[model samples]
Target: REDPSDAIVLKSGLHLDKPLDILFDTKAGTIGTSSLRRIAQLKQLNPEIKIQDVRGNLNTRLAKLDDKNGDYSALILASAGLKRSDFNGRISHQLRDNWYYAVGQGALAIETRVGDTFTLDLLKPLIDLKTTYECLAERTFMQQLEGGCSVPIGVHTSWNNDNQSLLTLEGIVLSLDGRTKVQNKMTIDLNERLVNANIDDSSCPFNYTDIAINQMSDHIVVNKLRNSAILGYELAQSLTELGAKRILDAIKRQ
Candidate 1:
């Protein structure tokens, strides 16, 4: 974050290559939204996945997934968690890559006081500009759509294959049952989006006067970030125009 609150968000990371012949999970709150989206997506290609509310930490859950007598076929999990705990090798029959994860899924975040220069200075060097941009765009989409656990929105952000400077955002809205789908994507030249932009003092909404923009180099970083956020907004607009709102609204009503 240019200022504070969110210096990071869940990011996609390595996961086990575990095969997906079954489905189960350690139930939780907001994170479960991603699980719902996963189940909704995977059910389309495989037989119905078993959804159960297992209680436990990563260890307990994996134990259940590995229990020989257990009926669990698969356990929905954050690949980042698996990787962080050094259990990525346990993953199999992956579903993460075959479809978009939720906005900001698996992201890592660092939080600090709004004007804490000391903390900001210490953390600034750790920020990855590309990952920062990607998270910002995804956060923007989720924010614009007003999507939550009930709506089950999906999004993916990546750099262009041919040109490293270009970024593309793909968003999908799926019914809880996975029968209905509305998807759209937008690509932008990350460097080009700012050419005609009004780069004034008001350019970056999250501008940290003392930290992020004190130097010209930091100013440019925030500028690129501001433009990346707009990509999410623009993509949300495109999605709404294509009846994504209707799909979400209907899901909400249910």
Candidate 2:
């Protein structure tokens, strides 16, 4: 289904007043945030439910659910990964817009150690500004929450370049049972900075294209993005602290 339509369907299925949880793969990245929030809410009401973890590769993970002896009540995987692995049939649950995909889960990254002038120069031109900013915000959010790929969280970001660089990020946290949820959004200005000296389009050691290279350095913009993501994370934390923990405790008792 189209993203908007899919979002509608997923949103309609959520029970924000109840506690629910989700399990996702590490490769699926940051989509688990929303899942955790939703599930937490459900736990607040029942306080006797259970949310746990299960792991495996794509097909193997799905197979566990079908096995009669398997303990999982549901499975969560990236829409992209499912499509890539040709396992769309396994996605019994698709989250709503508030609980959308993370920044770069389906994308690839090329990182070089700091001070590696050669690799830095080689990889600079290959960077996509939009992708870079979105991923930066999402990763920052994950880091601030001290959450890993296994958490029930999700983040989706957008950029507006009309005047200043403005980024909008939507985030979600869910409980394990997929019953409770919480979501929030934040925006930031992308300040410009000088480009890294090591990054150039010259046909030197690493030949690359200079596509959408902003005159402003991505460093400052990335920092702002990180802060924005943290803002969303803090909001989620508040919700978790106030009500989500209760739900989790109740679920554990069950």
Candidate 3:
């Protein structure tokens, strides 16, 4: 789990698929925006579902859900939590495909003080290169849109199962009311990454830096991460072009 750098994805997939009735996030201080998009999406298809505020740990919420007289018919939760709590048996159904989750939802991070070369080098051996790149892209997308825990932004990022360098990112921006949304997606093949190494730094700027030679990382690895970030930036721009900005603006006013 030691991957040297300021930050690296420990692992993602910490999210549940769709089919969650509420956007239940106990870890984050911001759950309002998280619920609107999915709740709206699911409710449109199943109007019988209603949202209620329930506060407690995982098992407590489950108890409320099980209460016959309680208002909750179902409660949405992360499968990861269920497994971690040894309550995997409680997972009746999981929504996986086409589920948009909070940005960086399922991703874990190993953070180090910037420029800590010794520690960074120590972590190189354990890095999952593919997952790290995927997170770079996802995080870049969130940052580009100024998204955070409080923003009603949802995203899904994945690398091709067969081709790790082929990345797909899908994102959504929802108004606070969940009545309006703008979504878009994009793909990037890191294989198409810039090949010329001697190019001027100003012409092709990147957030990627100093992993290979300086930190005992592959020089090419830095570029791959940069490409992943570029994919995110472009996707955010595309979503904005599709009116995501308006939705976000309205949300900010709220």
Candidate 4:
């Protein structure tokens, strides 16, 4: 999050209390408008705040926050980054439920040249099954909307860990301005066949990949995340139809 100790007024006739975090790197893509709303709320609370622009890669951005000179107070990077760089210790906070993260932000992806079964097999165990499936739903939702990095979007997935295991997905889209947002949620029961695949010895066998997904679905905390994504998507769609485009157009113009 940016901390402009200075204050600036917005076109909306609102004043910011502190600097707001608005920039999404090319790597993180365009974040959904729902995230922007949170920043707006902060502004509403503190009308004297200032907003500024900052640009850099993940490591460079973090360095700005940790700079001994105190040029910055905090930095917000994707949770996935810490895992990728093995820098989990650097995460000052984990905004898991309240802040909707980018699709596949904390997950790992494996890409290989075509026909590389050897490498695929080597990396197969490293894959997280739940993360894969959840990401699948998220990516699918985003792709269906014909959106790219610039689109404001968020998604989350979870599994029902009751005696009957089921998969649930939620997605959100938002306009560039903080004014409008949309969200959606869906569920699927994977208990019968999906669970069996993990338990059966004859099958490929379930690994941490599978376990992580199942655990995520079954976990109580993830339930809120699932719902948040759903609400966010519905809100985004509605906002888009109701003049979100105008706000975005203005943002682009500026």
Candidate 5:
């Protein structure tokens, strides 16, 4: 399975050519954020090409692209959905890794109404700690940056399982015209994050039975979540200082 964030899917047997109109769904928040970046990258390669807003579900969008009635040379979609639908073979281009994906892309969310303790309890065990940490960082970044679903904000996060569990976050904000862009990256040590949470490293007993690390799982995970949020807020602040605030404000005005 490939990471589908901002990936391009073309008509079968067709390859990318010059001056193509890339189809994307403006209704989906990710399109506005990532498509703009893709458009910028494409312009760098071929200035004549353009991006078109197309609205529909996966099947409907695919139908339009297959029929070629929308004048779209290719369609860009999240690889996660394509792969989940067993359509990985249809991907023509994976896009470049340099492109940041929509915050929490490819991850699932569990939402429970207020006072719904039953539902919350049911979902607790299903939570993926690493994914939770990453999503928290991303969401915090967006929150601190005052970005919304419609804003052109993007992020990518990774959990390193090396010497100490390390969480790295990379984020960006791009102008609507795909011209101006601001990006930043940050990393934090998950263990130290726990220590900062008042969990004494020397006193804490960690069971190394599982390589994935389940020692004091709940405590470590909770602290990791907190640390991730702080990291995201800090990174967003860094980007703001780099002039992302201006770029974001300009996009909002448009």
Candidate 6:
């Protein structure tokens, strides 16, 4: 299961309805967008509210938030991380609306020596194939676009497991100031591709072989993966055509 992207953790007794100052870590692009988006939205409502950056691990950050004398009235954090640290109670609001998650956010990944069948076998049962497919599309989009921490790029993906599994991807490129953004969504019927590739629907969880180890080969399943990745590449191309590249390029010169 994918965890929610990011959330607002307020000081004890603080309310979301109340005006407040916010704190966030600015080093990581994923969390940086969270802060910038909130700042942009809040500026429209409470022009005087403050936002500042304070970097630390989950525990250290929690210590800062719990300090009564802390300057920040609230904290923006990954809901998944907060929960993992056993501080879910501090989360007052999950930020999703008008927010696109970082590519592959909240998804777990394990990397081992290539061709390590032992590790692969151990991890195979825990793998969520649907999430894998979704993340693959997002990562492919980022890789092809050459997205990096400096570029404010994000994506959200959903998989519908109906009679035909359909994958929907929404991607965005934003200006540093957060005042401008280009976003687009695309959907592809992945089940159709799998069917055409002769992959059985009964295979509830596709074997890892479906993923091309390095590049395309004789495996029919590899084509299915390639098609799914192509969907993302196509979406990125459409967004670039709609001026995403210009926006990204302008940001880079800064």
RMSD, every candidate, angstroms: 7.3, 10.5, 8.2, 11.4, 7.5, 6.7
TM-score of 4: 0.54
lDDT tens digits, residue span 1-254, model 5: 13627667776445545212343323221221135545555444344445566667888777766773445556777889888888887776676467777777787765556446567667667766777667767777887788866777878787666644788999888776557778889998866643233223332222110012233347766566557666777899899999999998887787
**Pairs in steric clash, model 6:** none
As for TM-score, the candidate ahead, 2 or 5, is 5
- 129 Cα displacement, candidate 4 (Å): 2.7
**Candidates ranked by TM-score, best first?**
5, 6, 1, 3, 4, 2
TM-score top scorer? 5
- The Cα local distance difference test for each model comes to 0.60, 0.48, 0.59, 0.44, 0.64, 0.63
Clashes per prediction?
18, 53, 5, 27, 1, 0
RMSD to native, candidate 5: 7.5
- The number of residue pairs in model 6 that clash at the backbone is 0
lDDT ranking, best first: 5, 6, 1, 3, 2, 4
Whole-model lDDT, candidate 6?
Answer: 0.63
Error of 4 at 66 (Å): 2.9
Model 3 lDDT tens row, 7-29: 10111222344324233333312
Q: What is the Å distance of residue 23 in model 2 from its true position?
A: 13
Instruction: Residues 55-102, candidate 2: write the lDDT tens digits.
Output: 667566556555555555454455666666666544555655334564
Question: What are the TM-scores, per candidate, against the unseen true structure?
Answer: 0.76, 0.51, 0.74, 0.54, 0.78, 0.76
Off by over 4 Å in 1: 1-34, 194-217
